[model samples]
Target: MKSLICLLFLALLSSPLLAQDIFSSKNTHFSFFSSSPLEDIEAKTEKGVSAINIKTKAIYFKVPIASFQFRQKLMQEHFNQNYLESDKYPYAEFKGKVLDDADLSKDGTYQVTVEGILNLHGVDKTYKEKGTITVKGGNITAGATFNIRIADHRIDIPTIVVKNIAEVVAVTVNALYTVVNR
Candidate 1:
């Protein structure tokens, strides 16, 4: 635990652009859905961690692939063993910056564009997406929805189950952050 804290501090201090203003959440909610002609699949997890620097408008997220829970045990098992390969690639991460002029210290909701690289299944992909950030009463709430192509991340599906899984999955992330490391 002490080493983890030290690492977190190192990560925050290593960023030259970030100011001292930081917000973080360990219980971030993340979900994904796939609707296809054969079957509709969905899964959700709250075991995500995220942090943001108000000064630099930089954001980061990390979620364990094994944390996501599906309704069926077989589906979860297949997802981890066959699709995501959680044993080999354990986590998904995102590093990006908010492209907006709004002051994060103020209280309001802002529609912001974020550009970042998402690493999933050991593959890194550049993404430019939009999300909502709301600052109120000294807390921050952020949410975003995006689509990820399974093939882009080298997550191959067997031909037999191709109809069950969609080529693209819709992902949603929500985090409520409070001031941290101050």
Candidate 2:
């Protein structure tokens, strides 16, 4: 028994641990909404990524800006031209992590806080929001909502169309992840 204990202690002390990293990508369904007094609008981005590395404290997500498809062409044009500037700033990005010390290996619902930097329209803003994440059947599911003021991101609006756009735009993020071994 003493030998067994020594062996166990030695093994525990000698074991080398590679950093815990979470590899993820956007699942098929990701949606966003932009509403104006003139009309209610919605769109989706099919491609995205969820990345986290516990060791490096690196977290990032990317959504292709041009992938958003709206019902109206004029609205789409305004989004690409004025709000998102999708041609110049083609992708929207966020970097952060689950605020609470989350047990990724277990299956449960966790309320998490995400503090990250958002880049859009040639501007970067630090945003922290609360969200929910679920781990089920080898899949990671997350959803969050945060509001962005249009002017904060350097998105310019003409006075004529100011009424057509909302001053504060609410952003909703839904991301899905499939684990990958690194």
Candidate 3:
């Protein structure tokens, strides 16, 4: 009887149900923001998505810049036409990990910090930020609010419109990812 119990324990340990899962692109979000004296501009393109691997804590996100539609038509045109040059540079991507030695046990909220390479307007910059994740019912939802400076990515700011746009822009990010079993 004891041998049978031990056998069952080892079998459970080897099963996929006991292991962490890495979700697919359907479980991610990528967005950006820019503040100008003309207005505080923000937009998100849901057309793009990302995926996360829970066991490895790997994250990958992609978004097509042309899909980011601004509220004001003129602003949208300016973004795609002048700044982003969407026809030439059409996408942004990020790939990295949540951080070192992080635990993601279910039933509590965990503070998560992510370090990744942000590719914007054809430039790649290293970035790091702290956020939170909630594991509920075998699923994890992560969210964070941070800021990014455009100049860091070599986004040229015309001196003529210096006052119109703020160098610093605040961003809010929220992504809910479901666990996938393999």
Candidate 4:
């Protein structure tokens, strides 16, 4: 009986359930674009961090608001100080789950919908966005594009420069993930 119990324990330890299920990317790319009649504003940053758990279908992402770089220095300054108020809300984060049951271990592309709360400018709003995830050779890559209304996040635009900024901005995210060794 003791031998049988030991065998079961060994089997459990070697099971696929015990394998690495978490994948992470430290340098995720995040960008946003605003188009208006006056001008178009764009910024991008690669300092974001993201993670996914294949077993639980959980996803998480966080990026510093001030890390975004604009083409013009003045625009970058205004974005951090006046629009985003980066000093007050240092980071924007998303915590959500993948709605699809895609086998991440397989090498294929999967369409996924993620529903989560996005905390930006100290306001939390729920968003459901569609994204594509490609798994190849034990690596995963995810890309998504979504729109965010400035009013939803309580971001106020001064009337004087209102024409330069759009009411809704297009946001794009890309991440290349590797398995997290435990």
Which has the greatest lDDT? Answer: 1
Model 2, runs deviating above 4 Å: 1-20, 53-58
Ranking by TM-score: 1, 4, 2, 3
- Candidate 4 displacement at residue 153 in angstroms: 0.3
Ranking by lDDT: 1, 4, 3, 2
lDDT of candidate 1 over 58-147, digit per residue (tens): 788888899999999999999999999999999898888898897999999999999989999999999999999999999999999999
Model 3: runs farther than 4 Å from truth? 1-20, 25-31, 36-38
Superposition TM-score, candidate 3 onto the true structure: 0.78
TM-scores of all predicted structures = 0.93, 0.80, 0.78, 0.90
Question: Judged by TM-score, which candidate is best?
Answer: 1
Clashes of each: 0, 0, 1, 0
Pick by TM-score: 3 or 4, better one: 4
Superposed by TM-score, candidate 1 places the C-alpha of residue 125 at a distance from the truth, in angstroms, of 0.3
Per-model lDDT: 0.88, 0.67, 0.67, 0.87
lDDT score for residue 182 of model 3: 41
What are the clashing pairs of model 3? 37-164
lDDT of 1 at 175: 96
Instruction: Give stretches of model 4 more than 4 Å off.
Output: 1-19
| Candidate 2: tens digits of C-alpha lDDT, residues 1-182 | 33422332232232343423454554434566657888566777666555544333345666767778788888778788767888899877776656678776567888878787888777899988888878787666777777888789888889987776778777777767665453
